[model samples]
Target: MTTPTDFLLWVRGPGFDIALVVFILGVIIRLLEVLVLGRKHDYSEPRGGELGPGLKTVVTRTLPETGSFKRAPFTVIGGYIWHIGFFISLFLFVPHIELINATLGLSWPGIASNLVDAVAAVTIVTLIAMLFSRLTHPVKRYLSGPEDYLTWLVTFLPMLTGYLAYHRMIDPYPLVLGLHILSVEVLMIVFPFTKLMHAFTFFIARWYNGAMSGRRGVQS
Candidate 1:
């Protein structure tokens, strides 16, 4: 019989190490493939050119427009709310920050646990809202497949499990904690292989688009 202690050890030890290795190497490999796939040279003469405009475009995209909020209120609101909560819980939660501090020899002030809990609850709510939208909206529903929902679930599990464990909603504390760590490892392993790659590729893709448009002499 596997004791809770053994399960916890596995999750925190080899399981985590394997997940980290796979996550790092997979990200590196995928990133290299994208970078080395070199684009065709654009030989056209420019009417105007400023890399600044491209950079501006990249920066601007980070902030959604009021028009977009009006157009897709739920999506815009849910997106911002979820991301805010996600980051707060991921980085500011006491345990998570402590883990990072221990691992990287870096540290930041952690927020109050109550605040982290609230943010995590918000994250769960927003994620559910987003998932519901995906299931009900015609365009999103049509565009989505198993992989899309799978990625969403994979992304959602660690948050949900952590929330449960934090509150002791689950009886066996060790098992729940182990499950939470396992979910994170699962997410790391699945990350590069799924649409979740957006976590990393989004920046590169945006930079390329911005640079190309900037070189074209058009204000992006």
Candidate 2:
């Protein structure tokens, strides 16, 4: 029988290595594909500078208009809350910061662990609410597919497991920590191939849209 210690070792070592390789390769290949499938060259004369408008759009498009937010307050608010929570949980936690420093030789101070724990808890709750909304809202439910649920599952697991691990809620500490690490590895492996790729590509997409509009002398 594989003991919890054994599982922990596997996930912390070989599992992490495999996930890292897959994440790097998958992201690189996807980026290359996007680059190779470049947009058609425009021959039209430029009416204004493309750089300024492109950068401006990148900033502007980050938040929706007031009217749009008012119409979809739950989505807008929930989205921001979870997004910020995820960022803090991922980048501001001491253990995660240590991991990043070990991986990239970059180090930064992390916030209090209690604060991270609270954020993770809130993020999990927000995700649940989002899921409920998706399931109940007719238009959202109609538009959602297996991919949507799968992404949500993968995203939620890490937060849930990490919170459990940190609190030592499970009987076997190593087992819960191992599960948390494994869940994170699963997320990393799935990230490059799924909508999670938006973390990286959203900026590229926004920049492209802005640049095109700028070239046409219009706001994106």
Candidate 3:
């Protein structure tokens, strides 16, 4: 008979090893792309043909007045909540924490089980809402391509499966866990080539914006 121990072994051994390798390779490829092929723009001047005012303008005046935030607040908020919750669940979930404690001798602060459950639920819901918004919103609909929707599907499935595994619903816990791991493996395999690449590029873009504003004597 299949036991919890058996399932745990599969996850911690081959499943984890494969996931780790894929994650590492995906990150390396994404970084290489950014380093080698990413776009280069001179943001030294503002959108208008001027020196973008000054550092004060870049820092306080121009940047804050930018309408991008108001254009898509739902996407922004959903993205933030989903990401934060996913990372928290990944690093702090009990089983994962136990694994880390065993393999790496690292200990993280433990959260109550109920709180963890709540976080996972919120993450999944927000992600779903974001997906729905993408489908229904006119602007998002206009902008989204097949790859965009596919990326969201790929990203959302693992989270949903993982949460199901945690709750031990439907299939046996072991099977659900395996499926979760597999979904994540698929995501890792496709990370560098998909819209998911934003995970790696977002920070770079933010930094570039900040730097350009600084150089131009504008407030960001």
lDDT of 2 by residue, 1-220 (tens): 2899999999999999999999999999998999899988899998778888878877898888899899899999999999999999999999999988988999999999999999999999999999999999999999999989999999999999999999999969999999999999999999999999998888888888899888888878
Candidate 2 local lDDT, residue 92? 99
Write the residue-wise lDDT of candidate 1 on 172-209 in tens digits. Answer: 89989999999999999998888789878877777777
Best-performing candidate as measured by TM-score? 2
RMSD of each: 1.6, 1.0, 5.5
lDDT for each residue of candidate 3 in 1-220, tens digit (9 for 90 to 100): 2875576677657877887787788888778877888566764454432233332333453232337569767776787799889888888788778868998999888777778889999999998899889889988899999998888888888878887887888466767887787787778777777878877766566666665656666555
Clashes of 3: 13
The local distance difference test score of each candidate is 0.88, 0.93, 0.74
TM-score of 3: 0.74
Residue 116 local lDDT, model 3: 80
Q: Which residue pairs collide, candidate 1?
A: none
> Against the true structure, candidate 1 has what lDDT?
0.88
**TM-score of each predicted structure versus truth:** 0.93, 0.97, 0.74
List the candidates ranked by lDDT, beginning with the highest: 2, 1, 3
Candidate achieving the largest lDDT: 2
